[model samples]
Target: MTITSPSSEAPDWPQCAHEADGRRCRGRPVEPYAACLAHIGVDRRAGHLAALEPGAGLDLRGTPFTRDLLTELLAALTDPATGRHRLGPADFEEAEFSGDAQFARVDFTGDVSFDGAAFGGGAYFTGARFEADLGFVGATVARNVWLDGVECGGGVCFNKTRIDGELRLETGTITKSAVFRGLVVGGDATFSGIEFIEPAVFMETEINGTAWFDGALFRSDVRFDGARIAGKAWFDGAEFHHDARFDSATLSEDVSFNGTRFVEGAAFPGATIGGDVEFGGNEIGGDVTFRKATFQRTTVLGPLVFPRLLDLSDAEFQSAVTIEAAVGTLHCRRTRWSSTAALRLRHAEVDVSDAVLQFPVSIAGRSHPFVADGRELEVPELSDAPVRVASLRGADAAHLVLTDVDLTGCQFVETVHLDQLRLDGRCPLASPPPGLRRIGRRPVRWTRRRTLAEEHHWRAERQGADGWTRAPGNTDVWGPAALAPVYRQLRKALEDGKDEPGAADFYYGEMEMRRLDPDTPPGERALLALYWAASGYGLRATRALGWLLLAVVATVLAMMLWGLPQDDPEPVSTGTVTGSRVTMTTDKPDPVNPQGSYGSRLSSERFEKSLRVVINSVVFRSSGQELTTAGTYVEMASRVAEPALLGLAVLAVRSRVKR
Candidate 1:
């Protein structure tokens, strides 16, 4: 192991040709020996170990060291003041350790490189501090690797490394960026309480054991895309100052992100979670997306405060999921829920368009804070914040329940099981425009009715109507024929809930659609038109009453002009007939029609008679007064028409006030 000059007779400098693990050693040979000190025989290694001094730089690249040999080298570099190995600049690149490598509490004042190194047994660097960058690129550890409490002033890289046993970086701090891309850990890996000052990349990394990242701080962006964790992954209390991407990652066991904070945004698109998941008590400053992700077990995704959007579009949940978020927008379009789910939100605009709901799902508006996982989460300061639903279009709503959710802009046209949807609390829908609006040349006053967003879009597009704003990107406008059934189903739902009064408006809407539907039969459409014009389909009491009053006035005027006699005739003895049988016969004069100068028929006496006759006709009663031939027909027509109008008015009143 002694250093000596090469022979002057040699044509070129000789290189060590020792081979191990199919790789030939390329270290410079010792002058007295054919191989470097690391690859030299054990009997000849004493001189190299004796030559090493504390704080010395060691270069063992491309060398192979046994456990005993490595110990002797480290012992030679041990500092007397601290009784610990103090290395200036250690380069172990392409080095192979045959047994356990112990470097615990070792201090490397200068840069350290273990790149392409292979450790046959456990490698310990616990409590070690590197003043500069620490590289483990392409390194292989056959057993556990302990890096707990290690501090690195510069960036740390474990890129493309493989650890067959446990890996611990707990309580470690990296001042610069940390790269773990394509790293593989076969046993449990702990990164708890680690502080990463710069961006951390873990793309395509695979951990077969439990992954712990609790209390980790990532000052810059962090990525774990395409990574696979076979066991549980705990990221509780972790903070990410910048964006965090976990796209296409796979977690086989329970994963927790509780109490985590993402200052920028986080994404998990196409990720798969095979076990239970906990995402509560999170503070996300920007948008968070889990689009197309799959959750195989129960998941609790809330008690979160999201300042921006939370997109779960195209996601699938195989088990029950509970979400308690105060997000700005929750997009769940095309999401599939195989089991029950609950959404307790505040100040969120939820869109569940085209979602597949296989079990009961409840979307409720929560005013108070949420208590989850033994933690009390605070809500936003906006006390009057409302949870509104943007759309239910193309959703199967048979098992859907809504509680205190605002549906003012919800589109229900393509929703399934609308009649079975349960609406609890004050689930408000959009109301039609107030007051009268001119449609074409005629003044049309829309009835105050709860309507769907699709209906608004349809009407707005059809008539260029005001007071209805179309939803963004919503180009599908349902026609009256399609909207008619939606309104009818909703009306039935309200009626079943014992909210007949609330159902009245929906019934009115249904009738309106039927009247306007071009596909409706001509005879049925005409009847519906008449029904609406006269009494608003038995839902507008004022309209019915107005028509009734007009009918009464017309009947009174007709009776005075032509349906009343000018005067009454007195009885007189006329003539004898058939001798004794007709000795004294009584004769009554026929009532005569009113003569010309019709204004005279408007006398107070005649008016009194006309008023009495019209009043009798309203009640389907005869006045028993003499009348002209035309007056007979007028009274008969009034008897049939006036009573029917009065009945319609009564029906309208009942419909509005029914319990």
Candidate 2:
């Protein structure tokens, strides 16, 4: 590539101003016009011919035609040497093509238009140059139309034009902008390595075949809003210096933005992609929005770099939504996700806020936790560096709304704003916060604690400002009314997302909420309290085990303090009415039994025996011994409460094991 500053020096010489493959030519001009020998031909004088001349075949093969006729110009040019016509015109409005139209290597120094014309054969404008605007409004090309390597100094409008065959504009350079609004392409339209210096508009255009835009560079904003493509759309390795929007565009086949870089962000809001949509290995400097977009098939989002916010608000996913990215931040408020399929987030480190997610999600085998600065989970080698996040708040989420969305696999590393959240259901929260710092008491001693989460938990669904104390959700103030639905949805989402362990956490949280709710019926609340106190809902078996141990300990202590029961002593051999003062009487005595005297007292031996009874009652077993009414009642209660608690412990263990 030769580096030449054509704009620095004065325009003295009229040379070949044509640029091929991004390099200007040094060919010397052969004419009074600013074109070289190759770019120039016999200068033909003609007024603005508004109508076609009376000829079946108009030949200007080597002649430079600079007329802006409103005639058919999309036809194949008649080979003057062979005197052959490619085809005739169709029954459309406007001028006839006299014959085939060809402008090979021709330099068009003036504006031109052949609006509403129809060509039966084809047209070739390969290596053509237009110093002014070029309009093909409402024209129809029945065959191939080659505009390969064309250069346009001004805008080129193809509005409402229809191309039946391939439309090639590879390596084309447009100085201004290209307008293809309402243009319809019946065949493939290739624009590989094309350059758009200004904003290009393709709004409301329809492409029946594949649309190739590989390596296309857009210096300014580009819009494909409301465009429809029935075939695959490839934008691999494209670069957009400004915002590139495809809002409301419909794609019937797969669409890829692989290796694309957007300096000003890209949007697909309200777009409906029928086939798989992929955005792998892209770089977004600004917000990449998918608001109100719908993906009927699988959508792969990964291996991308986002320096700014990524918004997916109000989007609907009919199938899987796999996100594997290094996003600076993510916003998905009111986004609807598929219940049958998954919303997988693998290895993503996102800073999310004001995100209302009630969709099933999976976060297993994911990268560390998703947390903003000040709320990062403490990985051994991880540092607490502040990362920029562009959400509603300057940093952290303000009011997140997870209304009717399922979020089963995600974790809450940041202190979430529970007050503003609206949770209809929740994912099982097995995820632990990275680390949190909180004020303990007196001198405001900030305590650092890491959440012991190995799974997902929806209550942990917070973004920014770490630690359970600082976390609005960790405040544990949401009443049963709010907590119930939140936990339910979270559990369902986690399950749907295939994060079972995470779902269990939300289940436990739900039961805990139930236990603490004062509005619950006293009986149900009592049971809930028992479950929570004994086992952390049927979700924490350790608590249940501890409750059993504590019960046993209490039973032992009671028996020790209240004294134990003893077996009846063997009767001593009574002497034959030895004396009446003591009223002692003895019967025949055996080795293990003897007739007792009328004198006895409670013994420590009996107290020791009573401890055995206590052990039996604690274990939901029984000691073969007669006891008082109170003791019987105590034994029965132990059989019911203690056994039930033990059962809960077993269930908790089973859940964990299964997970």
Question: For this target, which candidate reaches the highest TM-score against the unseen true structure?
Answer: 1
Pick out the ten consecutive residues of candidate 2 with the lowest summed lDDT. Answer: 446-455
- The TM-score of predicted model 2 comes to 0.57
Model 1 Cα lDDT, one tens digit per residue, 398-486: 88999999998888888988998888899888887888886666677677778877788888888777666565573677889899999
State the lDDT of candidate 2 residue by residue for 141-164, as single tens digits: 767778899888888888889788
| Runs in model 1 lying further than 4 Å from the true structure | 1-32, 38-44, 80-83, 372-383, 417-420, 436-444, 470-474, 492-500, 517-527, 560-562, 573-584, 594-611, 657-659
lDDT of 1: 0.84
- Candidate 2: where are CA atoms >4 Å away? 1-95, 115-121, 140-142, 294-342, 348-477, 484-511, 521-584, 587-659
